[model samples]
Target: MQAPSMWRHTLTFFPQFLAALKERAESDSTVTVIGASDGRLVVPLVAAGYRVIAIERDPIALHGGEVQLPGDRTGHAMGLIDRLKREGFYDRVQVVEDDFLETGPATTRCDAVWTSCSWHYSANHHQPLSEFVNRMQRLVRPGGLFGAEFMMPITQRHHMLEHYTSPERLRQYFIGDWDVLLTLRTNEFSEQAHVGQLQDHTHRMGLLLAARASTPS
Candidate 1:
């Protein structure tokens, strides 16, 4: 598939996926944010009256008002937020262009948190995940929602990229702390092969949705 074609597929499917997640949340006044939101796919959630915050590291992609290859991307988080506002989704969102690790602690206090396809890129996944969970616990006020989609590693003959956690690893990462509500795996193929091949294969991708563990009084 062409680059544009692949992007089209992403744009089409991402919104629907987010909608399904929203249905599962089932909350009228959930304050939500997207961590490392590349294409601003969750803008619809804002339009639906949810408070949204977006954080991204790439300035070009964040501010360009158009999605491009991560390498070719430019702009800041506020730029994207401004673009979204111009597009009529500003009422519910704020965008910050900075390292997510730095922002996790301060901004983690929201009713819901959604990290889509970006957790794998964290410099310190463990610390950030823990902090994120803790922040959700504090911000969500119990019975709120947290959702994430991550790339998973799979041992297969033909795969796409690298740097994904295996199923077992992911399980171990969240088991003791979070009560898992859903675990799903799927396969994705890239239109352009060999563009970047740092991994063995790409057969396994994971989605996890769970609420923060209620604090013990």
Candidate 2:
């Protein structure tokens, strides 16, 4: 499935996460996406035959709305719900419109959980970074995968907070009952403008992929 135009060229470790999912999960395995903005990753998971539990709080992203483009252009974004319907993957997804931290765990355990550049947002800074990571980890069942790609510290404000973290720092959270499969970090790199940020920006990012240990036989 094609991602929305605005999200098409973004940098994400989702491909790596997908590879882990394929190796570890069944075709019908349920994957939960925290901060599932506009189904960028959700649609593809559903298209690949996985059931998706999409948790997103933004109404504009989940339901569609006008957006400001890079060239002072105005565009109407096709929200996640509509995109799923258009692609005929709605039935494979359960969209939850709520603040992920405010909600409890899924009624059933998920085969995997993922979030991309989510915790760095100012809106999420009120909570400790550990809280966000811990919450996401809780949703994954034993033997399930947990993946996250996040912003690394680049500014004074970022340095002051634990939210803008590094791969090494994040690994501390996965020390027990989890296997740190892969960890990668990038130097500051330029990124093209997208819906929210209208100008080119530079960022340093990190990715972490871990698998929960299975229950003892």
Candidate 3:
């Protein structure tokens, strides 16, 4: 699919995705976006009336940083969140410039944590994925939501490919701990693009959704 089509597909997923979060989370809930490359999801999320803390490892990923949005085709800006300000959603947004893996578990918990393809970085950096899940699991308050579109290949090896975790391994990491919401395996259909030099193949992936189990009250 082309970029427009891919974006449209993603947009189709967002309504139900946001609806799930809205159903389970409070209107004022704070959401932490892992690898918030741009305001793509952040904008709508803010428009939905939730506070968002956008985290990005690479500072230059935001369109506001001298890179215009996809459709604009004109690069002009200083930071990604500039558009957020222009749209009056900046007050509801926060940017955290830190590596998700290196930053350690957050002391300040959030009502939900979200990520796109970026969640796999920690698994790539750290051995296995237990540490990464533990870190994210700690950040969300119990009963809070944790959602990400995961890259789950049929086979993965250290420094071998971009596929970070297998579906079964991810289950081992989250099942006992979280109440699974959605877990469906699919391929990388966005423009039929290939990723990485060694892997070079778009393998199977999963749209992961789970809610941290609430403590016994």
TM-score list, all predictions: 0.65, 0.95, 0.75
The parts of candidate 2 lying over 4 Å away from their true place are 1-5
- Give a tens-digit lDDT track for model 3, residues 66-166: 44334435443434466576678887888887777788658799999887776566444654467666777788888999877766654436336534655
> lDDT, candidate 1, residue 111?
61
Q: How high is the lDDT of residue 147 in model 1? A: 66
Which order, best to worst by lDDT?
2, 3, 1
Pairs with backbone N, CA or C atoms under 3 Å apart (clashes), candidate 2: none
Q: After superposing candidate 1 on the true structure, give the runs of residues whose Cα lies further than 4 Å from its correct spot.
A: 1-7, 11-28, 65-79, 122-139, 154-163, 173-177, 191-203, 213-217
TM-score of 3: 0.75
lDDT, residue 72, model 2: 95
How accurate locally, in lDDT, is each candidate? 0.53, 0.90, 0.66
- lDDT by residue for model 1 over 1-217, one digit each (tens)? 1112212333123443465557755534555555544434555666666766676776655654433334444322334544575667665566767776666456346666766666555454645455544553445545566666666655452133333653444555454446666666677644332212322333346776665566632
**Alpha carbon lDDT at 211, candidate 1:** 57
